[model samples]
Target: MTNAHHLQNNKPQDIAINDDWFDVLKISDYLFAISEPRHYEHTVVYLLLGSDRAILIDTGCGIGNLRRVVEQLTSFPITVVNTHTHLDHLGSNHQFSEIMMFDHPRSRDLSSNGASRDLLHWELHREELVIPPWPRDFHIAESALPPFKVSRWLKHDDVLEIADIRFRVLHTPGEAPDHMCLLDQTHRILFSGDILLNGPVWSHLDGGDVGELRDSYERLMRRVNEFDVVMPSHNTPCQNKDLLPLELAASNDVLSGKAQPQVGTDLWGRRYNKYDFGRISILSKYPQ
Candidate 1:
């Protein structure tokens, strides 16, 4: 519940990329948060540096040159680890040579087919959804997410070590079936994907299950003491571990029918019942 604004307000002096599309914030000397503030999702990707290599968490909505921005951050041969195959998270996966993904059918399908202009047409054309001063080279009419090859497919409890740093891949599927969270227990940081964010958690989307989301939150709660901070993929970057209980209680209330929800509709016109819980909310399919 601590003010997360300090993560963004304290800018690092060593950032080399001076682009308008991406905002890079230094969480620590070894970790950085790369975010897309212009987009509605306000998606964030993480960069973790070790002694010999570096890991780049989810890539943002491919609006700008994420690979270029990452290159300036570290020169340790970046490896892209996608928390999920959602279009917003994997847009820049093609830009990286080595890509890691969860072993799931949905992840394979999206990575192979990529996101077409038609699929992203609504999001790209929405002027109000995007903040002004868009990227100079990006053209909404011609934009399309390119497919990237998955160098390796990982599973639950898989531990990845990059020199000195280690991340345990925890399969916490809810937001997406392939969604996974990277737990750096040594540093007490959890790179929570779309599962836990600052805004609404969409369990109404295709392949999203509210029950599974509740289970995932419950699982994280069991080991709440393991992590000190959560680096979420949307809205804010750093969140205290105390957020786990709040989200869990919200999900529990919704499932038990103890909470009343408001009708909500997305950009695609899909209807959902939204349960608001202040800093975070849950969007579930109606009649659930």
Candidate 2:
């Protein structure tokens, strides 16, 4: 198995060689993170190869050619799944033939219109240079979420077996109503989409719920012992299991008013309280 880092170090011509568009990180011989480090979102999509098939988690911001990048990774039959219907996460959904997601109305709506440039502008404005700057000749207005249909609907507890690895689907809603996390029983690793991350967990967005997110965190805490590593869909590729508890604590603090919240506004001009914990932060609207 070639180390993903080593594989990433050598960029082949077949792949989209936009130096600024994507950063491919190999987690294992069969697992890789296709990250957009240059973008403000630092969006990441994962590719997991099994003996028989492969899976892609989240398609990433549609600023570059993601399909070409994945083609460079493996030739196995690939199945795409989105953690939620958020534009940044599902931006490249149109590039794939088969897409599986939770049975959700918002998911349907997002997949239909392609995320609006109106909303994507908010993210583009936050761009910061990490390694590469934005792609040359790239304009924020030119990017739009491409519309695609869900090939299948995945239910909670649906077990996806790709060769020797078995992943159990976990319905983790808080960030988005249709949010999901995958638990790999083979590796004891949790593919925690946007539910948990080192960055600000946005529960202030439409269809987000602070109370429900707290409940979701509590549920994950109970099953914390089951997974060893937590892989999120943003900024960083992997995080320690201990980070879960810290995030849970932050959520609890927000719910209980234990920590003071600083006023902050979201991209849409809506005011929300931002609670910053050392390891993670929670941005949520005060409960109605």
Candidate 3:
């Protein structure tokens, strides 16, 4: 694993952000997001500078001149990664023939959650749905696009060194069963996918299990000391890595039946509301 010699000794720095047409964050040798504008959509993309080539985390929604935005950055051999199959995480998937995701059985299906389907034609800037139930159709043109190489599926504790940027992958199951977070040990940064957002936690209970989310959070906290900075896919850059513990305290309040479903601003400058359907149901099952 070759580390970029220049990014060393970064003592907890607020990621350099620029709002020049595109929302950006310079995290070490990688870039967090170039901007994706949907409230629930994540605009996180990473420009991993590698020894030989480079890799991008997720393609910004192919819309909004992302093609032009990336070109302004670098022109290395770019490989795209979708934290999962959510439409927001895969807007520009069709743009790249060589993309990858968790090789789970469900990975083959290009469909997404109900909310995502509510965003069909969103990439085309045509989110107008005449019918009340029509908007729940947002997702990729799975059939229209080319086949992807589901060659690599990371497991917990797996380390991926791409674009010369090293990441310790944590298989976080909630939000998306195949979601993974990236960690930069040198700076103790945790590239929390959609798992640790700074806003209201989405209790997407439909197929999501709250118990599992609780477990994942515990696992994440166990390793919180491993990372001092957390770079979430959405919202603002990591301000303090200690937020992990703070979040844990809040979560415990909810888990212990002390708090109600809360809506608040989370990491990444964006505000989020995590009151997904299954939230109440999951919380009800807890011994609280």
Candidate 4:
């Protein structure tokens, strides 16, 4: 509410989504994400109030102009993070100057290209993009959000203390080694990054691992009783207070064995399928 530009100007058109809290079309005070018809048109970055300041998860491709949108929303310093360093997620990193990344071999090892080539292709063509992403730039671009810095490298079990909130980092590697989830026990909310341990949730086809993903899902399910809401970086959030238990149960079965997957669908008409594979071989079986 303290942001200098609040209500003073209009938010960027490309990055704005209709607010859907309680189904009311009001601008969400907690977070806002813009979508381009690319990268599966995955929702990017969740803005929320922390114990101390505002926190932003995954700066979707700079194409969405996420920083500009957040700038008008809050005066608090934004803590930029990532689900993983794929182009769609990390496009806006260079803008903040000091962005944060988890300390994992895949995350830390940025030898020029910054992101691994294989993962880059996968996150992009997860069955062709829908978000209408910006024109491809061959050269890797650093953050362009500006007026900030990037100096946070999170670790497993690490805790982040913002102005008044505390977030526990769970290094649940699946989509990428640097992947993590933020547990806000106080609010019973888990900001699930790519560690979305669910039906076909693991993208083993894109540098994802079956074994690590299973472990991540298992770890989360064991702690499911502690949280009530899952605000995933992509896809719709599950605010059902009683849904965690169901998600947890299904998660356990998937970890120990394969699921029949009675039926499931992602927001974008993405249908789920069933599959079986060894552990690095973890992959999704999507219905074409």
* Number of the top lDDT candidate: 1
Per-residue alpha-carbon lDDT of candidate 1 for residues 57-78, written as tens digits (9 for 90 to 100): 9888888889889888888998
Global local distance difference test of model 2: 0.78
Positional deviation of residue 233's Cα in model 3 after best superposition, in angstroms: 1.2
- Most accurate candidate by TM-score: 1
Give the range where candidate 4 is weakest over 10 consecutive residues by summed lDDT.
18-27
Error of 2 at 22 (Å): 0.4
State model 1's lDDT: 0.83
Instruction: State the TM-score for model 4.
Output: 0.66
Cα error, residue 257 of model 3, in Å, equals 1.1
Better of 1 and 2 by TM-score: 1
Off by over 4 Å in 1: 1-16, 123-126
TM for every model, in the order presented, reads 0.92, 0.86, 0.69, 0.66
Give the range of the ten consecutive residues with the poorest summed lDDT in model 1: 1-10
For all predictions, the C-alpha RMSD in Å is 3.5, 4.6, 7.5, 8.3
Model 3 spans with C-alpha error above 4 angstroms = 1-21, 27-32, 37-42, 111-119, 122-147, 262-288
lDDT of each: 0.83, 0.78, 0.54, 0.54
Q: What is the alpha-carbon RMSD of candidate 2 to the true structure?
A: 4.6
Weakest 10 consecutive residues of candidate 3 by summed lDDT: 279-288
What does candidate 3's lDDT look like per residue over 93-124, in tens digits?
65664566765656666623222433444432
